[model samples]
Target chain A: MIKVQQKDFNYSLEVAALSEGNHDVGGVCAFSGLVRDLVGDKHIDYMTLEHYPGMTEKCLAEIEAEAHHRWPLEKTLIIHRYGRLEPGDQIVLVAVSSVHREAAFDACRFLIDFLKTNAPFWKLECTGGDSKWVTAKDTDTQACDRWLNGDKKE
Target chain B: MKILYFSWVRDRIDLGNEEIVLPENVTTVEQLVNWLQSKGDGYASAFADLSMIRVAVNQEHVKLGHPIGENDEVAFFPPVTGG
Candidate 1:
């Protein structure tokens, strides 16, 4: 499943719901991304995230499909939020369940890595007296590319 | 045609979205950017760094060489910053 919305999500409850009553699933790996208070030396007061309405969901769905194709995952859930968010708030949640622990871990990592580099979302940071647009980091692209090149060798 | 701007493009351009009609010669994303840059000072500044700006044609992320047609929704923005 894939979802992009503006409301905050309950991560723990979401994990339980995704893993509940699945006997075939022997392992579940999950990740949650939170809003950091600082970016470099700048102190972020808040952040406003924006996304292309219909396109964002489409891109996320494609990512999920790719993960399933690569790993034998029994279930997956991706939840991303937009609009204004503050420090310590949950920004995204990714979970993968599989019969094996390695598959679950790898798929979970792959989902988050791809979402960071390829998702069509923009973030605007507000500092004390000014606000600025955050630039894309090169590290994110490298992280996502690792999966395409089969760096993990799984 | 709908033209959507995001992130710093919106800040520099001072608008998020607009309706526009491209000239017949503006057939590619590069050409569209060149034409838009000439519209006014704001557009010129917003599109000043063409290399840093990314384009999406019809909701799919595309490059400068991407072909654009009439009534197609095009989006311009800075590189994505999502995780």
Candidate 2:
């Protein structure tokens, strides 16, 4: 499942719904991202997220498909929120369920990592009387690129 | 053809999107960028650095050398920063 929305999601509800009728599922791993109050020393008042309407969904589906292709997975869910968000708001959720813990854990990490670099969403940080677009981090791209080289860091 | 801009590219260009009939020579993303640069200072400033821009044709990411059709939807934006 993939969702791109402005409304905040309920993590517990989403996870429960994911593993609801699956008795074969042994473990579920989930990751949720939050909006931080501060970036470096600057206090962020709020953030506005923007995305390409048609392209964002397409990229997310491709990322999810890639994760499925790489691992033995039972179920996967991705929910990313956009629009104006305050500090401490949930920005994204990625969850995976599988027959064992190993696949669930690795696939969950892979899903989020790929989404960070591939998804077409942009964030604009707003401070008091000032605002700027969030710069893309090299670390995020590096995190995604490592998966392609068959190098999984322990 | 429809040219779409996002993030700082849209801000710098002062327009979100526009429709234009492509010139005969503008057959690739590189040539399209070069053509757009001649529009005015806004486009020139937005496209000052090629490394700062990313392009997509018909909603799919592509390189500057990628071929573009006459009716394709081309978008220009910065690198993605989503999670």
What class would a CAPRI assessor give candidate 2's docking?
high
Q: Which ten residues in a row have the lowest lDDT in candidate 2 chain B?
A: B74-83
What lDDT is reached at residue A1 by model 2? 91
- TM-score of the second chain for every model: 0.94, 0.98
**In candidate 1, which residue pairs clash?**
none
Q: Model 2 chain A — which ten-residue stretch has the worst lDDT?
A: A145-154
Maximum-lDDT candidate: 2
Per-model TM-score (chain A alone): 0.96, 0.97
lDDT of 1 by residue, A1-154 (tens): 9878889998888888777998888989999999999888878999999888887888899999999999888999999999999999999999998999999999999999999887889888998878787888888889888888988748
| lDDT, residue B83, candidate 2 | 78
Residue-level error in angstroms, candidate 2, position B44: 0.7
Give the TM-score of each candidate: 0.95, 0.98
**What DockQ does model 2 achieve?**
0.88
Model 2 lDDT per residue over A13-108, tens place? 998877898898899999999999999999999999999999988988998898888888889999999999999999999999989899899999
- Give each prediction's root-mean-square deviation over alpha carbons: 1.3, 1.2
